[model samples]
Target: MSDQHLLLLSILTPFAGAIGIVLLRQRPNLREAVTLLSATLVCIIVVTIFMRFDNAGLMAVDIAEPLPGLKIRFEIESLGMLFALVASMLWLITSIYAIGYMRQHKEKNQTRFYAMFAIAIGSTLGIAFAGNLITLFLWYELLTISTYPLVAHAGNKKARHGARTYLGILLGTSIGLLLLAILITYNVAGTLDFQQGGILAGKLDPAWSGLLYALFIFGIGKAAVMPFHRWLPAAMVAPTPVSALLHAVAVVKAGVFTVLKVTIYIFGTDFITSSGANDWLIWFAGATILLASLIAMIQDNLKMRLAYSTISQLSYIVLGALLATNTSLLGAALHISMHAFAKITLFFAAGAILVAAHKTDISDMGGLGRAMPITFGAFLIGSLSIIGLPPFGGMWSKWYLGMGMVETGQWLLLSVLLASSLLNIAYLLPIPARAFFGKAPDGTTHHRIKEAPPSCLVAMTITSLACVLLFFYPDPFYELAMDIGGTK
Candidate 1:
């Protein structure tokens, strides 16, 4: 079979799974089986594509010309292939995790949750393989719509409010600013196809490029740069699997991925750097990174704190894109995979804690780790990785990002990176620290809480181990990043 056909199949597999899930709605076991089977199939397909990946873009398929000179297309590039691989493989892991979580929690609308989860993965694949801005925008909006149901799974007032904000911000930004940016870009360049160097370099005037850059960055609200980041914490009312999907696997990754995509393929890194079009982005991202970390330190709710931590971590990617140096772009690319593994491990641990201890607040988690040591241990690994410490995947990305800053002589940004890591420790380490070392409240001894279900433990442990594996085997990601910059 051709790669193009495989590309199409990867996108369709999840949608087909969603249908199968609905058809087997009465049989919860069968419905979950469909999710697992489809996830496995999609992972295999994406991995095959990754193995076949080449510097010359493969699987290029122009499916339609929606308007004169405007084609809707799909293709796999180094960066997009990396994202597709991450999202596709994690879909399988998250499905395993979700099955355990939903069954243990006895969540309502389990079928809907599974179905929407499948649809969201389909949209994510579309985003990853999108060959141009129009194809990307369509998939981007579809992802937002598909996940709204998952966000509001509880059917409560809080869930509804969160879903509304999620939809409102994502849609408003894309339609209002992102769409406008696309239109202006097409008008100026006469095309939307993503090119290796960039399609906008000579066509766009330097004087107005900054405004265009603002539209693209803020318009991709999923990046969670401040003023537009409230939707992230607001959506924490969602179940833990959905939180994992939003933060690590799909939503937030899409946002920062798009920012990096625009920087390298839409605007051309050299052009943005030389034109100073990215000046505002660098400052905004640094502020977002530090401020979000500061706010994360104050949150007592475990998931809420992780949500804020996601906001801060995402800014690192945006800052990398704005830096526009080869090393920084490489950092941005590596972080996409490193942070995914680490953050998902953290969220999976959070869910496991919720399932086993019935605890949500950090203050209440003291000594809980004594009983659920595995969950807390995984949480510790994830925290250290997020802190960008040694022997973890996250350190390499931060190292490249700091080196990027040095190459560009942006010591202020480098300082922000250092300070954010300290803040990452402040907010993230305390959870596991309290779980293991701190005393429980009221000075009372509580009954031993067991670890989460086997499925949850398997998922969290796999991700935690992956964080370590990435540190040792960082070459694959580094080579892919190098491919993106034509440095290979």
Candidate 2:
């Protein structure tokens, strides 16, 4: 089949599954089976597309414009390929994890949850391959609306509150900042197409360029730069699988990816560097990284801590993007892949612990390592990856990011990267350390907290193993990421 046809199918398959899930809701097992099958198929298609991609060519499809100069489209590009790879691969891990988590926790609306998950992944693919600002904005909003149901799947007061925050911030930012940015770009440039080296270079007033930069950065709320990050932590009321989707799989990844795309394809790196527009951006990213890490240290809830970790990790991408150097830009792109595998693995293990032990606080995990050794060991590996330590996939991305810092010769940013890495260790490593090394306060001998369900174990292990594999063979992804912006 044509790659364009497959690209369109990648978006539609999940939606098709969602509809099928609703039709078969009376049969829970069948509904979930459909979810698993469709998710697997989507991943298969994504890989096929990647393998077949003419590394140097663009595969595009365009539908009619709904209005003048605006249309629906999807394309195969290096950056979008990396994104599709992450979203599709993680969907498999998450689906496996969900089978165990939803069943063990006995979550309500099982069919609805799986259905929404399908649709969300679909929209993520839409965003990944979107050919222009108009296509991206439509799919971006679609992703927001699609995942809202999953955020509130619990239907509790906490879930409702989280849903409101998520909806409010995302919609508010998109309408308020993102839409305005698009209007301004079209007004100034007469087109909304994203191009390498940027369409706006030398065209925009150097002073007003900063305003455009601000609009794009804030407008794309998914990047979750602080002030905009409350929505993320608040959304932690979601089920762990949904949290996995939020932090690792689709939602937040989409946000940062959009920012990276805009910075490279809309503004052009040299233009940003010359305009000094990125000077303020670097500080913004550094602030978010440091501040979010501090907040994570204070969060007792394991998932909330991870949510904050996500906020901080996301800034790594933002920092690389704003640095606007080739190495830094590559680091930003690589981080998107590395962070997805590492963070999703962490979330899977967290979900496993909650399912088996009914515990959520780090303090409550004393000696869980004895019973859930495999899960915790994997968690530890994922943690190491996040801290950018060796033998795992995350090291390469951070190495590149740090190199980017040095390339730019920003000592302050170098310090920021170093300090943030230490902070990552403080918050992430402690969870597994406490799980294994910590002693129970009451001195109760609780040895029965075994590994979570087989499905959860299976899922976490797959992602954790993938992390190590990535460290050894990140070339494929590296090639695609470098080629995406044509930065290399």
lDDT of 1 by residue, 357-427 (tens): 88898899998888888999999999999899989999999999999999999999999999999989889
Each candidate's number of clashing pairs is 0, 0
Q: In angstroms, what RMSD does candidate 1 have relative to the true structure?
A: 0.9
- The alpha-carbon root-mean-square deviation between model 2 and the true structure, to one decimal in Å, is 1.1
User: Model 2 over residues 1-488: C-alpha lDDT tens digits?
Assistant: 88878888888899999999999999988988899889999999999999898766776799878878777777878888999999998897788889888998999889888888888999999999999988999989999998898888889898998999999999999999999998898888887787878888878988888889989988889899987988888878889998886656599989998998889888889899999888786788899999999999999889999999999999899888888888988889999999999999899888888899888888878877878898899899899999998898899999988998898899898898899899999988978887788876567755877779999999888999989999999998999878855656
Query: Which regions in candidate 1 have their CA more than 4 angstroms from the true location?
Result: none
How close is every model to the real structure, measured as TM-score? 0.99, 0.98
The model with the greatest lDDT is 1
Could you give me the TM-score of model 2 versus the true structure? 0.98
